[model samples]
Target chain A: MRKQWLKWLLPVLAFLVAFGLGRLDSRLYRQPIGQVIAVKTVKSVKTVDNFDNQDRTTTQEATVRFLNTSRRGQTTTITNQFTYSGTVDSPLRRGTQVFLTKSSGPWRLSNFKRDAIVLALAAFTLALLMLIVRKRLWFISASIAVNAILFTLATHIQTDASRPLVWVLFSGLAIVFAVVTALFVVGWRPVCAVVVGGTVGATALAVGLGYAIFALTGYRDLHLEAVKYVTQSPQLLFFIQIVIGSLGAVLDECSDIAISIMQLDGSGKKRFNAGMAIGRNVMGPLITVLFMIFIAETFAEAVLWLRNGNAIDQTISWVMGLGFAQSLISGFGIVIAIPLTSLLATLAGKKEVAA
Target chain B: MTTLSALALTLLVLMLAVGGKQGLSDAFALLLNAGLMILAVILIAGGFAPLAVAAVIGLIVLAVTIFLSTTDMNVAGPAFVASLLVMTGVIAVVVVGVLFSHTGGFGAEDTEDLEGFSLTVGVSFQQVLIATGLLSTLGAIAEAATAVAAGLIELGDDATAAGRQDIAQAIIGTALNTLFFGFFGGFSALFIWFAKLRYPFWEVLNDQIFAGELIQVLFSVIAVAATVPMTMWVVGRRHREEG
Candidate 1:
């Protein structure tokens, strides 16, 4: 009980701390700490690299004027220079809310201070609430702490999205250890089993995925980006990050649902059946939710591609090459979670042999 | 035809798998939510104070849905409160997201593709952006409400059957992660996609479309975060009241 209270208390403290840090960061950056009333994109100029590659190198230069409603509609205009990465030409127009920091003498752009606060607050609130309602506050808190670290690590990576192979390995190992530590702090035996099981399962899945990627695209030497700020094998770290990125929720779910089933089955039942049933119920619903989460995100992009009247081959290529990779990999984690948690619950229950 | 066929099959499979009754309920919920969201898009586009209307309708749906769904009224009641409170936070974040910073353009960031499509489709640029920002966050909010409501009920059910409040609390925590990961996973995939696509850092950050998407993402995150704790507080207080 006290442990649960501490879970809530810690997040509240963290919220307060993050709140303080955000304010400090805002002050340090001298960014506008005001509300935005209206955002307008005035002009867009697309610079092309070459007429031959004109289809590819269209860069958009947008002039955005923002009214800082947070401080009684203090207004500023910032020209956001960017490229048309999406298959389209122009981007959004005037009147959207965007966080901005001082870019030059008068302009501002978005950064960590403005963005992180909302994320931090949301994470803190959810973790705190889940703890209060479920009494698994500790586990939730540990997940948040690890997620925060990963968020930081993601920000710290200097390169583009793709990491070098070596860094991915080290980071994956590091993530496993960090998450294991967190699990140990919450419910050790169960968490340990989940970590081990999930890791083994994920590894098997990754190898299969890597080979599949190899066979399908046949473009093995594509210039994968390494972590930008950190000098390491970002690819290895990328995979690890995915593992770390994915593990917390699954682990949390596995431990959480497992424990709930144990408790629900009462102190008298043989417990194995209870564990199994809990796994069954939780796994099915979670799979549905996870599927929606992944599928919806990719669906939007896929829709856009198809809407453009692209060839079926081209659409499939896009989905297979990019959008679905992480989702498919994560799907493996979701499936593995079922058996992993169930098995762990069975094993953990054994320790209390005479109960 | 292919898309329709796939969707029909998927729905049919889901209906079979989850049981006809529960599956029907969930399907109804999705349709209702999607319809309301589309209506919200129109309303917000018609310049009806998007944030305010979104809040009222979102809260109402959350309240009405939980009340209607649950067998035990008390459980539904608190979940509703949590949903509202968290929703409040989400709205505030989104509103502040657009109005707080000096970055220009409509909607949150990452709607670059949408912006172009809107232009092609002959939709007004502002309308498209507003709809995007408003609609994008709706899924997150609805998902949170569903999870909180479900969590409360599940905990309550567990508590009643087993008589261990601690276990109920544990279940709630687990469910919260379920909600968190379920939502965040979707966003992270996109975020990583942007990174891999090598959208120029400065331009991507500075782009008005990107700005709109960022605001939407940030607001949804805030909403999810707020919903969790607020749900706890409201549910706890309501539980106390009932006791």
Candidate 2:
């Protein structure tokens, strides 16, 4: 009874402490932190465009208390300008902890210092994990920790490498991801070799097919350059996107197929047919799941482009082009994995009796 | 053929060959879902309240995906109820996350590409992010809920304590892998981008783009985890009332 009480109490206690810590952690920052105490719109001007997009721009005055640096407690009123669309700027709200930049006169709001929210959400997640997963929570936590370490290591390598190394590192990472899922989650048996091999082989063929088709098509209307935020070669970056994006999907489907097939008491042909049946059940949802993610990830940009007068098809090409390409490539990989994994799992596990 | 069209055609054919009529419906449903997405985007860009359009479309999309995925009321009924319950909680988390994170607008990197685009669309970017967050998790959360409900139903009259444990284990195991590896795989490029720019760790933590994605992924984990117990409770209650 006491242990049950402790389980519930512990997470609540941790969350409160973490929330307080996150709010107070502003003192640890090198950048200026401004806590909005008061804000008011000083002026509002309306702009109407030919595209039927009409919105107002506003200038505001905000009184803030400095929470960091030598001026730890100074209060000042800063002028801010923002727009309704918030394409570049949004209105400042009370109690928002904003990172400030000092250029010449008044300090400017750059980005929000959102550690409190990050910490609170993270703490909430951990608490839920402890409460829900309970005994086997260690497995989940350990995997996440390992992922963090590997990601950090990959980033460190990328920093020194002349070119972006996502394709290379994640190819290695995909292999690791597959092996771990097979070994730990799927429980490594000799048949897991089939799972790992099938996943990797399908990914290679799918990516290669995608690449070949794109190359043959001359990369036409596909706007690789539209990918945001990079000085690296966009083509290679797109390649990296396809490779990483498809790996999990292929692995998930392959592992599912391999496990289900190995459990069946039948000849290889029957096992393969049963595998196809199970694979068919999942095929649609798996393909659409990734595609929906891509669409949502790019939705805001696509909307903005449309509002800005870009045609629908043009906006799609510009904003969702890479995402669509990645989705299709991953789609190809997932379909290929169904049969490939079935064949491998059928051939590897158990002696077959003639039917 | 255009790259998008040609590739889409190939995918359709492959799905049909393997998945047959069921795969074809799956592909068709996906197309319909995409159409809904585009319609929602158009409505928002036409100056409708982003939140309202998102809310309505979110419901319809959920129904479309859930009801279409199966004809079994036994599965779809419980799955739909559990999903709506989970979505309400998820939306609350998302609203707070978006409000505090301030990741509404396009980041500085997108500025170059959006140079000539007008910024006066009159729609709230925060709401847009909120909408996107809702849409993004629908597939995952719904899928998880359905899987749980379906598994429990498949157990039929023998949903003993041990059987429940087995189903829970299988569901959680798959959820962890699907959510974790999917995020890792999807975000690898962004990680490299962060490294190539050589942003400091603190800056990366505070960056709107990276922090937003990381926070949402954590929420996805919580949502999927929550679905298991929620689903069991929902199914259990329905059974009691029926009896």
Candidate 3:
């Protein structure tokens, strides 16, 4: 009956997600900033494919809905007719700010796409709920979401956000807090065990991954340039992202194997040896999947290089070098994370079983 | 042979060793999927209707490759049906999103950055968009098939076979998480890169190539979501039939 309820709950959940986003959007639009005062539907004619052949105009027409929000009402509707060499899609509506000026009137319509924000929110909500509803799946989403959200929030901290060093230092602390909270809530470990062990494991993993990326990237002058786009401090933030990124997968893997082993061993003292054996079994396949995923995604670039008839050396230089190096580094994190997380969970689970 | 060639050869050997005769068929499926992507670019460049043509060809090729490769016609039929259904669902969502976002038209940025290369290969923005939308969803489809196939195969692993419906239900749970993790590991890096770079959000959307990538990723997620339910339905029906 519980399962059936959850089954039928899908539509209700969908409605909630949609309504939540729509309400949020409507509220945001109602802010003092801009309210739609008028709307106009645009009708215009245009040619779509002018380069290939001149014979057809394509005769495209659509209602270009415009909105005016300012008190002055001086804004003009944004229209394709003014900017394009070809015929317009429709007559520009007076309220259509989508491509027209939102001001009182007479200015050129610069940009007009308004529906993207609503769509993004909807997509995000759907993505979140899809991964969030399942029992085990919730843990994965919680770990990633909490960490990401907290990381982003930390950016607003005056001390932490001001400098990369402070950011990493504080974030390192946040990760410890996050992991402990996650483990305690999801795994139901004692608070002390969750906090202390999470801190130790997260710190060790973060520092270790940092060393790995730096060593692999060769610490050449390129690090600075790469840091601009990738991380504030490539060396430090690389460590942080990997530490957070691997947390969910690693913790999930450990808990999964450990719980199963514990159930198999039931009512007896937890068997460390048996737990290790289970980890060993899961480790091989887990690592294989992690490795294959990273490698396979790069397959397109490989194919592109091959098709271009690029020499092997040239191909690696252009197509594979950076992506490959990053993959190896991340793969290593995935590999090491399994054991680290497994060992920690085993110890924790063992204590519970014995108690 | 070069290192990559060596690596490719090794992958082939591993696939064959592990998957045996199934590996050959898997190879055919992979080739067909990749070929569809290329053919999409070609068709769109030739000014054919990109979506309609690619959809037809993609469906035909996928169906033929999967059916020919499997002994279990029951599994192939439903899995193929599920894949197409999932693809349709994903496309509908994308079209709706495009409409609401009011994000239409190709960006000059894509042309400036990749147009030369695309032209050299006879590919266009339209073709690239179609290829990306279709191919991005392939991983989920393949995962769905493998899950169903493995489930049904396990029922007769030895002399004895389990209840078909029971096995399908169990397999559905396993496959759902596997597909998620598979996508997780592959897409995480790109996700982090985009976030870390803090590229202006509007700029990324305005650039058609990046927009294409975003669309592909979103569609792929939708594909997985749609596939899970459809796969379960198909497998359930097949199990009932066999029973």
Best by TM-score: 2
**Against the native chain B, what TM-score does each candidate's chain B reach?**
0.65, 0.93, 0.65
TM-score (C-alpha) between model 3 and the true structure: 0.56
Candidate 1 stretches with Cα past 4 Å from truth are: A1-191, A195-246, A261-270, A280-332, A351-355, B1-89, B102-221, B225-243
Q: Considering summed lDDT, which 10 consecutive residues are worst modelled in model 3 chain B?
A: B113-122
Q: Which stretches of candidate 3 lie over 4 Å from their true place?
A: A1-68, A71-106, A110-145, A158-167, A170-181, A190-248, A266-325, A337-349, B1-85, B99-221
lDDT of 3 by residue, A4-90 (tens): 447545634564566345423422332122222444434433333323221122222223332323433332232244212111122
Better of 1 and 2 by lDDT: 2
- Tens digit per residue, CA lDDT, model 2, B47-165: 78887888788787778777777667999899889988988888887887888778887876567767777778777888898888887777777777777888899897789977887
* TM-score head-to-head 1 vs 3, winner: 3
Task: Output the worst ten-in-a-row residue range by lDDT, candidate 1 chain B.
Answer: B118-127
As a whole number from 0 to 100, the lDDT of residue B151 in candidate 1 is 60
lDDT value for model 3? 0.43
- By summed lDDT, which 10 consecutive residues of candidate 2 chain A come out lowest? A346-355
Per-candidate Cα RMSD to the true structure, in Å, reads 10.0, 3.0, 8.9
- Top lDDT prediction, candidate number: 2
Provide the DockQ value for model 3. 0.13
- Each model's TM-score, in the order given? 0.54, 0.92, 0.56
| Pairs that clash in candidate 2 | none
